[model samples]
Target: MTILIPAMTQAENHPVSLTDDRGKTIELAQPATRPAAISTFGADVSVALGRQPVAITTFGLQGVPAYLGPEMEKIPSLGPRHQPNLEQLSRIAPDLVFAIRRYTEKDGPQIEAIAPMVAMDLITLQDSLDAVALAGDALGRPQQAREINQRFKARLDSLAARSPGNRTVAILTSGGETPFVYYDHFLTASLLERLHFDNVGGSPPNPESGIPLGYRISLEALLALNPDVILLLPSNRQRGFTVNPVWPYLQAVKNDQVFEVGQHWKESAGPIARSLVLDDIERLLLPDDTPLKTSSR
Candidate 1:
């Protein structure tokens, strides 16, 4: 028997319609059954809401811990995290297509022709959490979404309780000559703040200095910050052991405080993925001797 569900409004007054990245109003006839997510974070939200999207961008998981599990590896790869295969996406004929703001703004009209597209604004960690909850509400999984949120908050609180002292960190997208640092609304900064860590410096020096949502950075500026801990994004162009090269001589690098985290965690913000990120952050901030508090979930 086929089950039919009606389209649910975002909030009591918000309604069931949303603007695509290109500013087109797309109305949902019903909750999406076959969803297509353009970003890795969007894919995580789809999975968290109990709908495995037919297509999804790829994820990087080189150094993630074991508890996060192997969920990402199981999904069908559409293409690189930021650059998705439009032709492949079109073939899927998804009921709903969720994409990042930039992706939708640039390609929404093209994607909308294939399916109803909704551009999600998920620049910050809080935004990511809210997106998950919103997706869950839309998909009728409010309880599951709430549980995920609680789990993340509990882990973050535990980490904060352990380290009352704040450590100043600088998150950079390492590449080129001048690495770009993420600011307040960026995903990495939001994640670090949730863990009770302070990000050094405020905003980019210039408006043009800000890297687009999913771009890489250089090493020269990274050395200048001399952050307490360094998170490295894996290099697709480099085949072998490509170290930070110059930055390794810096204080943070010399102390072996540099960690290689997955691009997905740093780049994407979703309930399940963010939960995994919070877990990794907990491992990074707290000692192994620190016991896990019983989760409120």
Candidate 2:
């Protein structure tokens, strides 16, 4: 029942118009039937709205997301999420394009020439929620979009109410010598914070460049923070930092609190991705005996 195909709402009667995160207003004559997803958020939202994208960018060179099922593999790849092949996009001839604001801003004009483009700023939790609603409007599923948003908010509140305590944590990635620590405002960290986990990375020193994902942290700096739990989002199984001389001294390491998470943690702005993230948090952080409602989609 989580995924339903409701009847078309107000979008059918009038031209669909909404401003994207880049502050650019895009108007569609009718609901888009052949949208291209430059970011996974668009694809995720599309599927939730009972539709599939005509084309999509790869999930960090892994190709289309297998978690989205076998159907996703058949979609034409526009290449990497950052800089998709414009030629391929042009060939696909998508009616609309959903792009990540930071990645597509420089090439917005080129994309617009091919089709209407909506550049989304999918950084924070609010950004994700708003993006879903905006995408719903474009896809002509506004009512379903509102229902999804409401369900997500209600689920988030339920999880927060069951938070154990304020345990200090850090979300790290990289298979190399230094691991990148995420900022608190990063979507994953933001979710953990809502679950009452204190992010050791905290907010950035300056807000000049808007919200940053994370920064590389040295072993010495990481040791100083000494978070209670360390979530490792490695590119591969080979974690070079674990072999370092200073690795054993960290509190999380000493207590065996370091956990390796999946790729979903990297791009978790969509409805399905967010739900899976909550599932991971509950499975990894909560005790086996802990009784809580599952958030899996």
Candidate 3:
């Protein structure tokens, strides 16, 4: 429904030629049946389209996410996303591997030795949808992908129409002496904005590096934002950072609106991940009396 998926683009044909976000043309001898994803994003999209990856890119000590629940236990790990284990991947012998465009640029030549790779950029919602549609073609599930896309667009439209005004939110990234305030280039803040939540912090200055969680700001600047809701990343309720003696006057801390969520909201840029993020927000923002249509998938 978003039209991000070009009507003329068809990957099912032999010698499929598709250009990734980096403008690299991915030429496939045939559509990949047994595929592999170089990151959690690719793996999640695969599962959403009703096909599981033979292997998923791992994150060293961090490991991959359990997006598929019980099905997660069945999938094998393929090492780190950026610097994958080519030896292990060769054994898996996948027909193709999906990768983040930026990370795979330098390693393209080497990765192709293991299996042809298709790189994608997950910068915005449309980008994620495009990647999903591409995956649908590769997995021979184009109809399923279109249905999911239509469903997602409807859900998003519903939220935009129903989102309340003046409910400002601020996101704090965990790590460093002072946790960073995330505005843009991250799923949580961006998606919340789409749902009509006013993000007081705004998006980060630069989004490509993916190193810094967000721009670190003094407590005074954060207080100036006066956000009604505060979301903390990589946080736990037991840590009790919100209840600390730091700021008794902060509205969010005083009102107990500070919440901690799993890493999916902060990282893992993909279509399925966005859907999961919307689910999380609807749970938190919607009220029992709020007369909005439920958009849960």
TM-score of 2: 0.91
Stronger candidate by lDDT (1 vs 3): 3
Error of 3 at 263 (Å): 2.3
Misplaced by over 4 Å in model 2 are 1-13, 288-297
Ten contiguous residues with the weakest lDDT in model 3 = 1-10
User: Which stretches of model 1 miss by more than 4 angstroms?
Assistant: 1-25, 59-77, 81-83, 175-177, 204-224, 238-248, 288-297
- Clash number for every model? 4, 0, 2
Please give the CA lDDT of all the candidate structures.
0.62, 0.83, 0.71
When summed lDDT is taken over every stretch of 10 residues in candidate 1, the lowest stretch is: 1-10
* Model 3 CA deviation exceeding 4 Å by range: 1-15, 59-62, 204-213, 235-245, 291-297
Top TM-score prediction, candidate number: 2
Native-vs-model 2 lDDT?
Answer: 0.83
The local distance difference test score of model 3 is 0.71
Candidate 1 accuracy as TM-score: 0.75
Ranking by lDDT: 2, 3, 1
Compared with the true structure, the alpha-carbon lDDT of candidate 1 equals 0.62
Per-model TM values vs. the true structure: 0.75, 0.91, 0.84
Error of 1 at 47 (Å): 1.4
Clashing pairs in 2: none
